[model samples]
Target: MALPDLARRAASRPRLPSLASQRRVSLCETLDRVLNKGAVVAGDIVISVAGVDLLYVGLNLVVTSVETMRNWKPAGTPVRQPEPLSQEIRP
Candidate 1:
């Protein structure tokens, strides 16, 4: 078949229905998925002037859950403990 005929036939055909689910996800679930499975990007930026390197910047970004952030601790750093609530009555 000619290219124009083939194009016309294809255009005349009905489009297939979308495969996506009709249900809507809640805000909490969306937030959980985004924070827990988000991508981490680490890179650097370099600026050159007249063929000479002028400036360089390093960037490291992480998007994660609050629990993950709380559990993360730097090497050799002491872990902090939450202070107990005072039982004394205030006047």
Candidate 2:
């Protein structure tokens, strides 16, 4: 019996980036450049319900910091997957 070449096997394996060497950022902010904070216009199509007419709507999204997210999880606790439902199928 012949043994497999260990050097060739190791070379074929993929190398992953080190977790410690990765960029550590407490918070990352991404701002909208096209229109940082402004209002948008919509086509003229007015419809009234009861007695009020719909005009316009705008939304702003804000992301929380990394430290706030990490604190949410309990320390040294394992996540358990929910068990599948037990049901009988009709033929």
Candidate 3:
């Protein structure tokens, strides 16, 4: 009884495209699409001591091609670069 139920569940699961049925994408094409559409890589890092988070670091990165940036803004909009995130610590 258990085995038959498990089989039925497996058969009902969604399946991905078969290898032959899917089109092959080159590295260049993949990179181009990602840059044009924009990709955000975000993560959080924690340095802890004895399960206590002593330091926490957040990271966010956006990677895009220069060509994509050229057309990123509206026709009448100005292009302004963002300020740097780092601050100089004067001791």
Across residues 1-91, which tens digit of lDDT does each residue of candidate 3 receive?
A: 5433432332232233453654433333433454444544344554323411111110011122322554587688775543222233579
Candidate 1's residue-wise lDDT over 13-79, tens digit each? 2232352543333333333454445554434554323311111110011112322444776678754
Pick the winner on lDDT between candidates 1 and 2. Answer: 1
- Let me know the TM-score candidate 2 reaches against the reference structure: 0.20
Q: How far off is residue 24 in model 3, in Å?
A: 1.3
| lDDT values, one for every candidate | 0.33, 0.29, 0.35
Give the 10-residue window scoring lowest on summed lDDT in candidate 2: 52-61
lDDT of 1 at 59: 8
Error of 2 at 22 (Å): 14
Better of 1 and 2 by TM-score: 1
Model 1 is weakest, by summed lDDT over 10 consecutive residues, at 52-61
**Tens digit of lDDT per residue, candidate 2, span 1-91?**
1112322222232233453544322211112332343454445664323311111111111122222333456677643322221223579
Clashing pairs in 3: none
Which has the higher TM-score value, candidate number 1 or candidate number 3? Answer: 1
Candidates' TM-scores? 0.23, 0.20, 0.19
* Pairs in clash, predicted candidate 2: none
- Could you report the Cα RMSD, in angstroms, for every candidate shown? 24.9, 23.6, 23.4
Looking at model 3, report the run of 10 residues with the lowest lDDT sum. Answer: 52-61
